[model samples]
Target: MAARAKREGVSPGELKGRLLAEGYAQRDHPGIVFRGPWHDRRAALAEGPDVWEVASRLRELDGPEEHRIAVLCEETALHPRHVRIAIDYAAEHLDEVLERIERNEEAAKRSRRAVQRRAALFAAVPDPGGRPRA
Candidate 1:
């Protein structure tokens, strides 16, 4: 049905409009068949791009902990004041900091795994005793 509609230069909305114009009505939701690109029909288009501009007031960050906080805060879209407050609040909460660290460790582990895999693949390729393969 969708292909036929498209070949005849029509979209789902156009087909739906024709049904309505012809006085055809469905009481239930008919299973929708996507006739266009999936991303093109996504809800994000209606909501627009998600962009949060965070300007950090703290120019200089002290210590490794403070440096990590500043970098992650800036990258994660948290405003300077909000990030500062959250970091300060989490400072006393050892559990939350540990949790964040655990997440970072997990990410590092994944990255290391990928690197090791690539290295192993490279190592598996034989040098062929320095003879060039034609």
Candidate 2:
């Protein structure tokens, strides 16, 4: 364990925590996996969106719990079982999942702002060719 931790660049305790968490998820959550860089690890379906995405969408939905689950499954093309896995994982790690969602939202906002600024800058630039500005 110590040697593996050294190879992973994390302390033994931290490595143990990761191993236990992964083990528990494997045993209980089947198709779920913790992924991403160490700084931004998140739970995700094997070949689908992160659990937080599903959870956030599930929050936006209205109606009975069963109805919401049905709608989400249809919209995402995920099985009900997969959706339930995300919901259950989100319930267990609410703060972590919500924080990731918020961080993603902030990153998206920053990206949009950068794109707008770039577009405005390009618009202000005079054309290199001998054509009049539109």
Worst 10 residues of 2 by lDDT: 125-134
RMSD of each candidate relative to the true structure = 14.9, 2.3
CA lDDT scores, all candidates in order: 0.44, 0.86
Which 10-residue span in candidate 1 carries the lowest summed lDDT? 42-51
Model 2 ranges off by over 4 Å: 129-134
| Model 1 alpha-carbon drift over 4 Å, by segment | 1-78, 126-134
Give the per-residue lDDT of model 1 (tens digit) for 15-132. 6675563232111211211222432221111121111111112223455656755685666655444554444433433463455455656888999999999888777766769743
Residues 22-69 of candidate 2 have per-residue lDDT tens digits of 779767877889888655678998878899999888889999888999
TM-score per prediction, in order, is 0.34, 0.83
How many times do residue backbones clash in model 1?
A: 0
TM-score of 2: 0.83
Clashes of each: 0, 0
Highest lDDT against the true fold, candidate: 2
- The model with the greatest TM-score is 2
